[model samples]
Target: MNPRLKHLVVALSLSLLAAVFTPAHSADTKKADAAAVVQLQQRMDAAEKHYRDAMLAEDEDAAATATTSALAEMKAVVDACTKQRGCAVDTMLTTYERLLKATPQFDDGMPAADEDPLDERDFTAANVPDTANAASLLSEDGQRFVKMVQFNPAVQAGIRRWLTDMRPSLMDSYENYRYMQAQMAPAFKQHGLPEALLFGIMAKESNGKVHVGSRAGAVGPLQFMPATGRRFGLGNDGSGFDTRYDPKASADAAAQYLSERMAQLNNSIELSLAGYNGGEGRALRVFRDTGGRSFWDPDVYNQFPAETKDYVPMVIAAAWLFLHPKEYGIRWPSVSSRPSTITLAQPASLYELTICLGNWGSRDGYLRALRNLNPRWAADDMLPAGTSLNATFRISWLYRFNCAHGQRMALAKQLMASNVQSALVRVGEPTPAGSPQVAVATPAPSAAAAVPERKPAKPVKARHYKVKRGDTMSEIVRKFDCDLGDLAQANKLRKPRYALKPGQSLKLEGCKG
Candidate 1:
């Protein structure tokens, strides 16, 4: 318990006791006796303990549960206090507010509780969208989109996985998607594809994490391979920025790819998705060889690799869950994600922005949102003043209020400027007479003391390193503590994916070592 919270709680207890024994109380007025007061205090303390324990253990689900339980307990206490004639309800309400402030707002990583998992309507009604009366729940386009796909046991399994073990991932996906919906969803809508379908592919591909790069050379929110991405107008834009990492561009490309596949595969969403995961050439060959049979058919399904078999259903399942989250007891956190932009007030990095933003209206803060929106900028890169950044309306407001100029902003700047090297203690070193002394703990020598004359230092010469197998540009730069831009320029390497070959010698310029 926080010391302030403890003091507040004690004050609340005293106020309650005073209220209970007050002589000013009317004779007929109901008063909570000593025993009832003790029980209420115990409940409050127990709820707080449970919440603290869950948080300390980092059990996200348990913490969420405890938070809910604590809030409920506080509400019940407030209600009970209201009914008591002489109870200091204001003090109780203040205590509740303190508890609310004390509780940690866990991010989307925490899965919400699922209610009745045995609901027949969720699965049965899923088969037919029109008859399910989903019009009230979904858009006209959404309803039409759901009707295009058939639900089966495989999809049901996918749904089960999402609702159970993958619930946190699903929640994270939804949260990430919400911030990007304005940028990405319109591309799908223009292509006459469902937003849910776009979400499904993104969720399955990268869980809506924009900068994700796979071991197979696939990159971005939609996980596009370099060769394939180029085919769909996704690649480096000659500005060191990969368009494949751009949510809008990648979503547009995915929509176009899916549309092309649908046109060839008899308008089957499953077949189109299969073409996406498995090679398009293979899916096309399989479709023709199997006489254009359904994707679920044994011959057509077995034609794909095991990955595609899982991929198709999982994508569909994610899509279904996106459309029917409430049916599975998933109440997605409301996001104020209306699109807006903020021009930088001063030079600052994304890390500094994240720190200053302080999670005012969001659980996780604006780091992911900033990364997804501005894929061109690295988290630590300092953007020049007046540079416009893609952000939500809430984030823009937060930026104005908290990030512009404040103690928080100053703190964020200080934190970003901090270096791990400052904490390092060099061992087995006695400073040479002419060597520069670091200003850590050693006291400055007296001005009167004779200082040894030092020879002029030579200009730092450029160093070279041979690229080894499995070495990437990021790894090489980090290994030498080199400036990426400088190293790339020196080596005549392209931006974004700085393609390095084995045994290739790289000129290490502007490196610390």
Candidate 2:
């Protein structure tokens, strides 16, 4: 062949070879990529499922964690694609969009249709205004108070929001507030403040939950920050319990704080609420800068944070509802607020009690009510026998019928005792023999060989006891008839404040028959 033709022939053969092999190699790579995409998609689906499950469980913290993890996984897939050739960005993007679409969208202030409706009749009987006239609902003082507070479009919108989308939360706040009214209202009354104001602030602050603490280090039903709480005599009470968590104490402090703010701001409740939600210093500064102008004054209002602006109006709206529920067609559920006490006949936790009590008269179970009334005790705390807890008359009645030593109580106890760990076995491990099978020399037939009577093992009384579920130090001391002081000393426990955990061992010092 001619040299030029030979060279052309060689080049064409090489090009054809490249064309044939390149596609085969590309196909293998594409297959691997496809598998990888499928695996990543499966992970994303699993993470999305976990997030949905957590949200449905009402576990906001868990849902947040799951979201973070899922986002990280999606980012990993994206990063992996960037490092590889021929990665279908559109495919990955589509997968990402699908994963995001799987997340359920939650509408703020919206309740499910099947969600139990709040029994508004409770608040209606006591708080519903007579005559349905706004004027008739107000006293001379209330009239003046209302005039001082702004009821502009913003406030009206807040009221509508509360009555509509936020109705469930509003009702929940009312129910919780009623239980604490006896404890909180007197403080406001003593300060010559309206009780409605107290309820309004509480509804906005912690939803009337006494033990709630805010992210800003504010603690208790009133959501007082640490420094502010200390200023109002609401910090530690020498018993490791913050007085801020005490409904009466916190309410008294809140009343005092409000009174002080009112004094500084011409007794304007709006400015006072602004100060309560926004920083008091900022409210005071704005008030001084505006030369004691109204909180609704654009100049002064704009100075406060968005939260405070929303807060002042919402609080007023809630207070308005508290005073004029009938006009608005709001009927608060008539909860059994009559106070009572129940002494546990046997060991039980609040969880067990709530289960056995059954929601006979109440809408939900008595767990929240019980927990609110007894904030010092945890819901899962295994209460000792004979532990007397503060409760309502309704709870007392339910306890008598359901929780006082019967089939229900037994079932609850049995349920509480179920050990999932005991049921779980090692996946591939063989079960161990019950008794070691060993052969022994047979000297048993000797006539004189009577195994020396195992001197009846002298009954060794237990000198120490391991704490069991539902065991408390007080109950333990009582059970063993031990002196409290000596028992505490023996166990190195603090006096009058001993806590016992399951599996903890305690010495029976000074325990006598």
Candidate 3:
């Protein structure tokens, strides 16, 4: 044993014995002992430092030995503290936290500070338990989910779709889910549900976009209806923020809902999924009517609506692909998603932060990650300084080095402050030669200044716009930020289908900018 570790063991043993045998002590004596406990904490820190050094030096033998010594020391410290009076155990827990922070990236054969932690790994080391080999990296529940897959023609067809045209969506869902895995996966795990199942449901429902809403009135990554969401405690929290749009809360509700369905539906995943998509009442009725037959039984399957029929197989296929992406020649993007946070040094919006972050070490910017992690804030909402934003380790790091007091930061600020209305020029306005085209709003005259009589400004008239190729009425309305009814009325376009053809002329009214 190392001399420092041996000293830690002896100190802990003496402390435990004293705590057990001694009946009482003065306040001063207790305070003195607490101080001694604090001193003992240094040993654990030293052990961690040794472990980190060994890992950094690529001495696996030394690193393994240090790990064993450190864990034993931690256990002993915890044990002694439980018995020892006035031994502030928080000191010990903080030491353990530091060890955890250091240990996660090292177990994957990389240095703690330098490695991204997501490259060529199933999950962060902290997430996977007792992972002896690469194949065992999937949590026990994940393996169970893989075994549950029935691989029928519907699932096979779904898999073919995922591998072909839908491949981009599959990749995007994986990337989005990875960032939110820390927030969402644990709920399913706590309910003894599979993490892959959560991913599958999220992928099929919203492609892991938390704010996504369906035309059918379903919302969030899980696509819960308003009634179902309210049942699962996912509605408004009274501050106007819908909890369904919240990843962690929605995932918890989803897990609980699934657990209830599993209990009522005889633990049948397919039937539970059908209930989730079609209707729980319908699913229960079908199951009871079929004498608890397999979901594949035509009697049970035919009862579900066409949408539910397609939904179940697609979700299953996505889950299958999530677990076996490599088997089908699909290489998912490597994402660094270790949970971290950043306290804003100055007010900024997600859009500004995304611009400043500038896609460093990512194919796309961090806007999606920011939105998914901090769901309450809109992309363009400027969060105040000292606001703590949930982020990834890599993103926080980028914010520190790239986003603080840089040219890119200034540019981001400038871009967000700009207004498109300032750039617009009326069709009949005279062009002034040698005048700068930039439109600057003049400041209003001071209240105390002598005011001159001013003529009333003319009301701006409707502008004429030509219909372009491939332009739909809805698209044109959205592009011009026009009210649909007002736009239709101004252009004399028909109701319901306000159709348009190429090269047609129309008046742009009820539009801003």
Candidate with maximal TM-score = 1
RMSD of 3: 13.4
List the candidate numbers ranked by lDDT, top first.
1, 3, 2
How well is each residue in 250-341 modelled by candidate 1, as lDDT tens digits? 98999999999999999999999999999999999999999999999998998899999999999999888777766776766656565668
Provide the lowest-lDDT 10-residue window in model 1: 125-134
Tens digits of per-residue lDDT, candidate 3, 272-341, equal 9999999999999999999999899999999999999999999999888776654676656767777778
Candidate 1 residue runs with Cα over 4 Å from true position? 1-137, 424-508, 511-513
Tens-digit lDDT track of model 2 for 98-145 = 655333222222223332222223233234221112213446435555
Using all chains and alpha carbons, the TM-scores for the candidates as numbered come to 0.65, 0.57, 0.63
> lDDT value for candidate 2?
0.72
lDDT of 1 at 416: 64
Candidate 3 stretches with Cα past 4 Å from truth are 1-139, 424-513
